[model samples]
Target: MAETVKKATRESFGEALCELAEQNKDIVVFDADLAAATKTSIFQKANPDRFFDCGIAEGNMMGVAAGMAAAGKIPVAASFAMFATGRAFEQIRNSIAYPKLNVKIAGSHAGISTGEDGATHQCIEDIAIMRAIPNMVVLNPADHWEMKAATKAAIEYNGPVYIRLGRLAIDSFNDPETYSFELGKGITLHEGNDVTVIASGLVVNEALKAVKVLEAEGISARLINIHTIKPIDRDIVIKAAQETGRIITVEEHNVVGGLADAVCEVVTAECPVKVTRIGVQDEFGYSGPAWELLDAFKLTQPHIAQVIRDVVNEK
Candidate 1:
């Protein structure tokens, strides 16, 4: 048998959407003229009658999705992260979140990996914006398996959902044949007592690598993958704090409202653990390679491991 190649987040969105459409006839897909880029075109190709093109108007597309949800249809509105989160934010909050509609907003080309397109196309603040909306379930899947599982989970889940996907090829984490992902659940990747690294999305891949680096340095680093941002796993974070004593958070998003902030909110209020957040520190990114941008923002594996060391030493 040939070895199976894992798909990227973009590929996961394509596969998941098509699979869900096969099971549910009332599932409709709407794209803001970026179907190809957002990977919603996969659904469009499979079910042309059920897919809609809302042109470049993301706000109107969001409203259309909310209306579809009201009529008992599951509508997935797809667009770029910046446009979906920044441009259609009002519609998402008012039309979708306000009513707690069963609509999934899949934002693609997120973070600096959208790259070369420059700062205007990137969305470092998406997590912050979506987290602020009441009744919104924010999810940033770390790999192909998680992304597909999240899309399936979103269908059964009611209310508004924001599922962020990346444009670049993402790393694989979970087993595609067996791993099951649940919303608001955190998966512990590695166990250790020296320090804990809590991360979500693309940064989780780097954190996993950091764990190997720490092992070579005679440090046992705990790795926790926080896939769901909203309704974050409190128990996992608290347990990490109690076990590791020191905690550091990593995310491709800004430190403000992303995984870092979400973990900090839990640890500070309950455990009061020594926590350090490794992410973009309230600054915009410049045009560069995805890895370069991560390095520039101090979100690389070395930076995360160093932060883990610092946080552990602080205690």
Candidate 2:
């Protein structure tokens, strides 16, 4: 939130953990041999006594975090998105989410933008995977300030939480002094009556850019940023559906069960509205440059604006 600063959300995750540890002694961090990549090394550098490295075993690391949580410690388990939400999903579902333990799971390098890591490493289905677990709070912060605030929110909340962090360095959009992050509420960045664009995670910035472009072209599309997916802001979504009449969802995740499905679920039962989704199709991402892969998948500002244009014209 400082003059168009650019930073990876994972970097914010680490620094937030370390800084928050200063005031809270119960905060303990566990890394799955990815201290450097997940950026938990930032916390390890300062809070060595409170940080634990659990080798490369993500499942074991989650189990240990659960145990620590059971002992009344605020344990945070860190790992790549693939391992944290994919490989160790069963443990997370049964151990942490079942009893609603106060454990924070930080899944870094999420989505197709994870770059050269390829399909195997890029986790585009983590939102679906984690949101399916009851009692789990799923958070996908858009920028540095949001990530910092979201991390603090997850820590202060006494329940299981899944915080998604991106590997791509994105520009900060929200101002720290003026921005306030509500757990389950969506922030309406721009309001219009034509159509609403509800976006989450890394693609929110692109959606904002597209909203401005569409307005310049005489289209009036509303922009809403949904950072919390599990308990998505139903009232905001319902109002947008009822007012705008149409909605477009964008995310850096799979369209099948990610943000698209979440938005559809709200309108399906609340206020039926037509919805179009923009995200990775039901296919694996191949190895490529991060920005190029996003462009190829049509997740950039121009592509988003084009989608908005097409959706509007279809009326």
Candidate 3:
């Protein structure tokens, strides 16, 4: 097998923003003094006139993006997940979501994968907060290709969108040439009848790895990638629950309000099944290496596989 290309989703977001800006001049980008880290600097370099640096004020950046969106420009506000969704949440709720502006909020370095930046920087609750807002569309792309596609889709979409981006470099699983991105839809990567693993963001790759391990042990695991968390693909989730007696949700975020919550809502409403959520428990992350953090939090492939195995074995 050929080696898979690895790239951070933030890098994909920046490159996609630059590419989309070339096609649509209405696209504008705003950063809160962390463009380099968020990779929005790529857009700043390519479109200097359209890029605005809002110092260290993430809230102010969100307000500016809302104002720009009000004026018919597609404004993308980029910042760390903790600051973008945590600090500027009120601005995003009142200024952007209230009026239903076409502002695209990109939160990079999301989840515990933010590594040594530690608990202060790691954001595990952005998904829950963003999804709670009335007019917000939550998107959490899994791989480099998915991020690029989702970025373009968010630009074309005329509403408030919250896109979660990651800092960890992950293997590219989707083929850019063959991949087609649709909003509010889930992609089934593997087919199985026994159990279903619904996952998003960085954990999608881990879910894929766990599938191989389960298959070797005579378990058939279906893998679903939910790129859009809000307006989740309810039909696919309901179908998975109906066909597969057991369901496991894997995410790089907190188990409270991320992918697990979304899947549970669907399963509880439609076809009830035994749903197991694999993610960070309700707690802040600590300072550690990215891979180490994943293991410590039990987000690794073996951990994920074991959870699925237990669910399958449960009578």
TM-score against truth, every candidate: 0.96, 0.99, 0.98
* Local accuracy by lDDT, each model: 0.88, 0.94, 0.94
- State the lDDT of candidate 3 residue by residue for 1-315, as single tens digits: 334769999999999999999999999999999999999999999999999999999999999999999899999999999999999999999999999999999999999999999999999999999999999999999998999999999999999999999999999888876788999999999899889999999989999999988898999999999999999999999999989878999999999988999999988888888889899999999999999999999999999999988888888
Root-mean-square deviation of candidate 2 = 0.8
* Candidate 1 collision pairs: none
Q: Write the per-residue lDDT of candidate 1 for residues 52-138, one digit (tens) a residue.
A: 999999999999999999999999999999999999999999999999999999989888777788899889999999999999999
- Stretches > 4 Å off in candidate 1: 1-6
lDDT of 2 by residue, 144-184 (tens): 99999999999999999999999999999998889999899
Q: Name the TM-score of candidate 2.
A: 0.99
lDDT of 2: 0.94
Please give the lDDT score at residue 3 for candidate 2.
Answer: 86
TM-score of 3: 0.98
**Which candidate tops TM-score?**
2
Stretches of model 3 off by over 4 angstroms after superposition? 1-3
RMSD value for candidate 3: 1.1
